[model samples]
Target: MTTALIRPTADLYDSWAAAVNEFDGVHIDGSGLQAPVVPGRVTLDALIRDAAVLADTTVAPPEDRVHNDLYWIVDDREVVGFLSFRHTLNDWLREAGGHIGYAVRPSRRRQGYASAALALALDRAREIGLERVFITCDDDNVASARTIERAGGVLQDISDQTERGHSLLRRYWIAL
Candidate 1:
């Protein structure tokens, strides 16, 4: 089952917390979750408050970072992945990060979750009236490049990236 972002309900909060440890040091695209997943540092209230601050235009919009989170349910009740859909892009995003980003839990990866999640996020991008959106992946992230392609993304160009592990960025554009 797949679900879009919503205010975390009690059950949803519990679901998110259960997997928090699995993603302690990992960053999932579009989830908007902060890292470290410390033992006593996370609470349902805190998550809700943080998300509210992010969604509140007066609080978060000034930085050109307004985004919505989409959750992926893997079973009757657990979130397997998430995507962050930015309503608008800043300079860096416009050139690299693109309009959407996402990730699946390490435990849930290799099960085709990211691909499905990307497709779903595109639907979301469409819902918001986007005509086309950019999605970029590291040059070495073959899976992500494929996922973007599978979602109808066309190659845009290669960005000049020099990350520790890669020297290029594969950029794509998907027409909604």
Candidate 2:
């Protein structure tokens, strides 16, 4: 199935939250996951707010938010996954975050959603003046690595990240 990358909407947010809540097996990482509510209002609000940040270029937020937190949605009917983009040359971003991030819904895993969604996002990145993109996956996440590789990502290096308690990060880059 084809997936389109678009801006996040209220309905999309709702669906994303519902998917997260319903799919207990898929570990939704990134932001605001510790709250008691599965598909909580607070999380939705944050998603909306972040979308606004990505859209607004005038009054950009702090370096991390500006360089790292901006994301675009790959909504396949509902928001099945998200693609985040940042300039890899940025110091902090290159070290830990990289240029892109993504996740597929648990129920939607093993399908081509992640690879397809990432390709769409890479087009967006190139449109935004990026010649290449840096992406990272946990070393243990073979699926993620495969998705990246399938999307034409070339391995840069393997590094250990202490933030997630010794999780290894497999970094890759896709030249646009």
Candidate 3:
């Protein structure tokens, strides 16, 4: 199946909601969705609005945040995952978050969605004139590490100190 990244929209709410439900209490990285996302508590309209705001580079991000673009990873007509591309790294991002973040829906794992999305994101980074992008994954997340490596990500080092709620993080840099 061909995978593509698109901005979040109201039209894909049903599929997006279903994917969100599949997350349960786990964090859906790259998805700008707020935590403890109860089904009825979050509306498609509100999410769409928030996504728009996050993607608006004209608007200044908060002191600790950087301007970012959020994209839903779609395969066919299904919302299979999400990706976030930060235009610049903040101090916290420099340590852990990196230039991009993404997550494949739990049900869609191991189907090449993430790898495809990462490849596409690298293209986007190049388009934006970035020479390279920094990425990080949990030290225990072997699958993600492999995904990064497959994308030509060179391992920098693993940090054991806590940063942005992650204790052990493996950092990499992917040259565009």
Candidate 4:
């Protein structure tokens, strides 16, 4: 399957919603969608609007957030995952969030979509003139750690304390 990252669009609402609903209350890390997704609560128009706002650097972000580029991971015409590339790191990001975040739909996990998407994100990061990027995953998420390592990420350190939804974060840096 041909995997690519595309900006979220209204035309793919049905496909995106289907994949998102499968999360069953789990957080979709990179999706701009609100956490613990309430089925039927997120409208397509709202999602499209939110995505536009997130991608618009001119628009000031909320106090605790940074401007980010959000993309939907598509395999051909289906939305299988989401990714967020922060333009700059905020305090929280420096501690845990990192420069890039991503999540594959439950059904799409272990299929290499995350790897392909991360590779694509890295290319975009380079094109935007980033010298390197920081990334983190839960220490227990062996698959994600492997994905980052495969992308040339070197381990920095693991956070000593739990932050947010993650128990312990494995931080890595990929030099571009």
Candidate 5:
């Protein structure tokens, strides 16, 4: 029941509101949207706005770019588990955000959703002509590291991402 990234329909927004209200770990999938966002009905418009930067010549070219949202149909409802991306991991991106991000609802974790979602996202990344992509996880996030490993992610470096007082960042790379 996966659908291409599109404007948030009324039904989709309503479902997203309900799911995220009760599920803190479940992030709204916005990679599929026209821009980068937290993936929620509340931020849809803003996300679209950020994505508009792509139209500027100052930004990188738009080829081989695809954003994706990971939605899980639970009890006949669409519960967004996480969002990932298939895009260019520029120098800045390599240092911080990497190429993907994901989260699973606390109540729905340990059920393999993140693993499945990431695997799917990586497949899409390969389809977009990425020979390899960088993905970062918190050093303490064993679950996330395992998910990356399952997707064939190889450890690259562990750097302190505390410039703004954040935690350690572990970088990995996966070959398509």
Candidate 6:
């Protein structure tokens, strides 16, 4: 298999449109994920602009939000997954979310795209000077836990969060 590449969305809206339609126009959880393709690419253009603004560390978010960067995990110019790096953890994130979040297209699962994308995300984290990055997966999501372990994540603790739909969360930390 050809190696996957991580790139920001630019002129790839056409390719992205196809992926968006693959899920019948439902916007999934990924930075610049699927959205309805309107005439003239207006929606795509707006998404691109928002992604750029989100990447800017200088801009401060409301008290609840944290800094983050969004990236697409591409292979052969097709988007297979997306990775979002939370530059720092807020209190809510520390207990639940974490430093990074990612989701591979259902059709591309089990193809090693997730692991590769995570490695790429970690490189970005290191570049940003993070000493350790926290990652979490639902306890029931064995595949996700395996992906995390493959990327050098060490088991830290299990957090219970039934109220959030995640019955139990297995939190891990990767040392940079």
**lDDT per residue as tens, model 6, 28-139:** 5555554553323776677667677767788886467777787777888887767788889998779888898887777888999888888888988999999999999889
Which regions in candidate 6 have their CA more than 4 angstroms from the true location? 2-10, 21-27, 32-43
- For each candidate in turn, the TM-score is 0.79, 0.81, 0.93, 0.92, 0.70, 0.83
Off by over 4 Å in 2: 22-37, 67-76, 87-89, 163-166
lDDT of 2 by residue, 1-176 (tens): 76776555566666767666755644444332333446667767776776666556567565555543444345446766666655435665676667777766677678787777777778878777898888888889999999889888899998988775548888898898
In candidate 4, list every pair of residues with a backbone clash: none
TM-score result, candidate 4 = 0.92
Full candidate order by TM-score, most accurate first: 3, 4, 6, 2, 1, 5
Residue 77 CA displacement from its true place in model 1, Å: 1.5
Q: Assess candidate 1 and give its lDDT.
A: 0.69
Worst 10 residues of 3 by lDDT: 36-45
> CA shift at 152, candidate 2, in angstroms?
1.8
Of the candidates numbered 5 and 6, which has the greater lDDT value? Answer: 6
Clashing pairs in 1: 29-102, 30-83, 30-84
| Pairs with steric clashes in candidate 3 | none
Better-scoring candidate (TM-score), 4 or 5: 4
Better model by lDDT: candidate 1 vs candidate 5: 1
Worst lDDT run of 10 residues, candidate 6, spans 31-40
